[model samples]
Target chain A: MIPYLIISPYIIFFLIFIAFPVLFSIFLTFNKWNIISPMQFSGFKNYIRLFQDALFFKSIYNTFIFLAINIPLQIVIALFLAEILNQKIKFRGFFRAAFFLPVVVSGVVVTILWQQLYGFDTGLLNRILVSLGFGRIGWLIDPKLAMPSIAIMATWKNVGLYIVLFLVGFQTVPKQYYEAADLEGASHWQKFFKITMPMINPTIFLVVILSTVGGFSLFIEPYILTGGGPLNSTLSAVLYIYKEGFFYYHMGYASTLGLFFALIIVSVVVIQKKFIEKEV
Target chain B: MKKTIIYTILIFGAIMFLYPFLLMITASIAPENEISKLTLLPSSISLNSYKQVFSKVPMGRAFINSLIVSSTITLGVLVFGSMVGYALSRLEFKGRNLVFYIIIFTMTLPFQITLIPQYIIMVKLGWVDTYLALIVPYLMNALGIIMFRQYFKAIPQDLIDAARIDGCGELRIIFRILWPNALPALVTVGIITFMGSWNEVLWPLIVIRDQNLMTMPQMVTLFVLGGRSEGQLGLKLASAVSLALPIAIAYMFFQKYFIQSIASTGIKG
Candidate 1:
């Protein structure tokens, strides 16, 4: 009774918000709703429509492209920064904090800030390029440039987090492994690949899955910066769902997409775990 | 010999990380014509954008709303999360593992799955456009419970045992004996909860329609994209800075706590 008493609020919230929404969301996939109108049964239409939805496929593809670019970029950069900062260094704490500054602010703030920076003619990047004897690059305007630009910004926003994670992982590793490597006349890259990499496999796996899941839910950046535009190039799966649900009020279809998106994410994480967790 | 290379690389990386923020601050303060210039240093500093943002928009209201929402949610999580966490950690009760497993499960469930249905829940309850819409659904965090549970488990059973022997009830034990010792966990969870609530955009954008009731991020997003800040680069940057600078400054001072929160929650991810 005492235990239940303490957890009752959570139990209530979980029932209403978590458990109910999950189950209700499934019910919603089979029905049509737009909130203002009555929910009409829609059967398998939403799922069937999803299979043929080019924009939906593009959104998912764009998200994967982001993950492909972001996760590796983030991991490599984070690991490098962590490797250097983990050693005896001046202002290590300050350096770590500097990289982490953007992580603390609102994503909207970061997205809006980068929107200004990624602006075509007025952007700092293009301005710098023109000044440096290079043609102006369309960081966000070009459909080809848009998703990758968002990916870079996403990496910038989140890599600090992975750096801290890798740092934590680095600390757990025994110094003797590196000491023995030094005695064996190992090169820098060799020690990192042999000693550091294998030891932090769990952290590596964790970073991959975190990035994958975070990548799957990319919204605010594209939502604010692009409106999933310039040929829907920046359309994220979650953003697509949001537009379908709120913007167009396609509640049932949005619910279907949400469920499908969640399924894709879970399967990916599970497969990723099986692939990586086994080695550990 | 190798130290110079590492230091130089680190300095370059630090500049890359901090450079945008310098421009944002400068652009927000720069006169209108200089706002679009790529220079980090503005030719002149003026508070015209800041003045416009305050007098013409409800920036202060959104800031206050964000403060009220974030702090309230944080306080709620600390109290409720700690209670349940302590109970699960200390109390021997039926269905304890069931409760713990549910939290672990909830931690894995993405918010997207719950997004539409939860909005429907809010709509059904007429919670849309209200503080209840903002605060109630997110008042308790599953991760906070897990953090507190893990933190509480590290305490010796004897401390709890002694507390019980001293006639401290479960609530008293958690609040008095346990909570003070759980300061680090408290701060970490508080930051996570507050930041999540503070930085939340999707739910607020979905639920909040009124500008006066908007959180800073939501209001700022609307203000920027809603054409109010059109061609007003200084004004837009000012609003972004207003939305960001407080939390960013806070992060600089207590970065350990902020970083610890992310590191701990990274395990959730």
Candidate 2:
């Protein structure tokens, strides 16, 4: 009884918020309910509708496009930044903080700030391009450019986190291994590939998973920057769910989408883990 | 030569990362006409935009609401989480392993899965547009419990036994003896929880429609997205600064612990 008392607070919250919602959401996927009415059983109607939904498919496709562009860019840029910072350098703390400043800022603020920079006209990027005699390009307004533009901003906002992760990974690589490589007259590239990359593989794997999850869960960026915009080009899975559930009040269908999204994320992560574990 | 190359790269990276913030702050204070200019320096700084932010929306109210909700949630997590942590780590009880596994599972489940149903629960309970809607659901964190459990496990069992021998209650043992030793973990979890609650937008956006009850991030988003401050670039940027400034200031002071906590705990923003 005393032990139960000790753990009651967590158990109560977990039951109400975490555990119950998960079960209730599953129940919701099989029923239709708006806030004003009582829930009614709908069998597999919601799931079937999800399969036939074009916007659902498009949102999933957009999310993958985001993941494809974002994962590599984040990895390369963060690794490069981490490597540079890991070196004996002046003002390392200042540089680290500066890079990390964006990560600490709210996503909405970052999105709004980027919206200003990516504005079609009178924006910073176009202004610089015009100064350099290049034609102005519609960043957020163009269908083809909108998703990539959002991806780039997402990378900038989040790369600071992976830099810190990679920095820690880089530091854990044994210095004596580098000494041995130097004794063997190994080139810098040779040593990095042979020693650094293999050792940091775990961190790389973690970054891949984290970024994939982050990319799929993207909401505020697209929500704020483009409002899933011009042609629904930047519409993400989570954003689609938000619109369906909140905007259209398709509670059952939205819950179905939510469940599918969670399953997709879990399966992708599991598969990635298995593949990476086999390799490692 | 290598040092010069490194410095150049670092400087460019710093510029890339820090420039938006510089732009935000300067743009907020810049004369309305000068906002679109690519200069870091505002031609003539003015408080006009900030003045507009307070008048245009419930910016001050939202800030206070955020402080109340985040601090309350943080305090609850610290107290309740440590209790659960102490029990799970120190007490030999049935279902302890089950409870621990449940927490681990909950941590892996993203909030999106629970979001709609949770909103329904909030609605049924008539919690909408209330601070209880924002704060109660978040009072206990699984990560905080897990973190505290690890911290408590490091303390020797003899101390706990000695306290028991002295007729000290479990609560007293926890608060009196164990907590003092676990200060660093408390700080780490506190900062992480505070930041998470402070910067959270999605939940508040879903739960609270009343402008007066909105968190800072939600208010800023609403103020910008609702077109309430349209074409007033300085005013828009001023709202962004209002949301970012408090956390940025806190980060500056606790930068070391902030970085350390995130890195050690593997919690992302």
Candidate 3:
């Protein structure tokens, strides 16, 4: 009875915040109504329409573009920097803090900062390029370049998290393993591939899955930077849902997209668990 | 030679990481035309942009609103999330394992899955356009609970047993003994939760319409990106600075604690 008294508040909070909303959202997927009106029964129409939605496909394509460029580059850069900093450098603590600085900054600030950096006319990137005689290039304005530009920004903002992760993973690899490899006359490259690679495989796998989910859920960056502009080239799945639900008031359609997005995450996560987990 | 090369690389990477922020401060002071010119440093410094943001945008009020909501929510996580985590970890209640498993399973569910339902609930409860809408639903974080549970499980059982043997209540054992031993874990969760709430923009954008209730991030989103001044670069840049500067100052001060907190979370991804 005493324990129940203590735990009841938490149980109540969780039910209100977590359990209730989850079950309600599933029910919402089957209804056809704007949030303002009486919800009408519309069995599977929203889900059916999703198959033929061109914008949905485009958003999916854009999302994959983000993940493809960001995850590998981020992981590789983080590993390199982590390895370099791990070598007992002067100001190692300062470098670590500097590398991790971007992680603590809010997503909104990062997006704003990047938008300025990638500004077509006044952007530092183009200014440097033109000064180098590479000529000015349109970054956010060109449809082809917009999503990749967003990916670059995403990588810059988030690579810090993975750097810290890789650093932690690097520390956990006992020094004796590397010492034994050194006695075998293994090159540094060989030691990294043969010894370090397998040991940190789990961390790498986790980063990939995280970057994938985060990639698909791209919202604030594109919304703030591009507004899904230049022919919707940068429009992401979550941004699309925001438009459908909030901008267009298509609650039923947005809920359907949400369900499908959840399915994709669940399936991909399961596949990763089955295949990637075994290899690592 | 290797050490020289490593220092060079570290210096280069640090510059790359810091350049955007440097340019942000510079451009926030740059004349509107110079904004598009790509100058690395400002020709002059002015507090005009900061003044413009504070006068035009409800920045002060928004900052206060954000402070209240995030602090309240952090306290809720520390007090409530710990109790729940303690019960799950140490108590022999029915459904204990099942409850733990369910919480872990829920973490995998994307926010979109419950976006609509949560919105409707907020609407039904008359919470829209209120701080409660922003803070109440997010009061219990799945990650916070899990982090606490992991830390609690690591505590030597003898402490809890000794507390029990002394005839102290279970709540006292948790609050007095377990919590004191768990300060690191609490700080870790506290910092992350506070940061998450402070930076959250989406729900606030939808739920808080009145200018007085808007959080800092949400307010900046509307003003800077909304093309409010016929594309005034100076004004927008100033607003962006206002949005970022407080958080940046906080980060600079508490960076050591912040990094340690993130490292301790052992976030898988």
For model 1 the local lDDT of residue B153 reads 94
Model 3 score (lDDT): 0.82
Report the lDDT tens digits of candidate 3 across residue range A114-209: 876787776778878988989777899999999999998888988888888888888778899999999999998798888988999888887888
Cα TM-score per model = 0.97, 0.98, 0.95
Candidate 1 CAPRI category: medium
Residue B197 Cα positional deviation in candidate 3, in Å, after optimal superposition: 1.0
Q: Please, what are the lDDT tens digits per residue for candidate 2 over residues B1-269?
A: 87888888889888888887888888888887787674688878888999988998989999999999999999999999899999999998999999999989987886668878888899889999899999999899888999999999999999999999999999999999999999999999998899888989888888899888999999999888888898678888899999999999999998988888877766655
Worst 10 residues of 1 chain B by lDDT: B260-269
**What is candidate 2's TM-score for chain A?**
0.97
**Candidate 3 C-alpha error for residue B206, in Å:** 1.8
- The digit string of per-residue lDDT tens for model 1 on B1-269 reads 79999999999999998888888998899888887774678888889999998877789999999999999999999999998888888888888999888998998897778899999999999999999999998888788888899999999989988989999999999999998898999998988888888888888999999888999999888888887876588888899999988788788778888889878787312
Residue B69's lDDT in candidate 1: 95
Q: Name model 3 segments beyond 4 Å from true.
A: B30-43, B161-167, B266-269
Clashing pairs in 1: none
Per-residue lDDT of candidate 2, residues A155-254 (tens digit): 9988988889999998889899999999999987798778998899999899989988888789989988888987999999889889988888878778
Q: Which of 1 and 3 is ahead in TM-score?
A: 1
Off by over 4 Å in 1: A278-280, B267-269
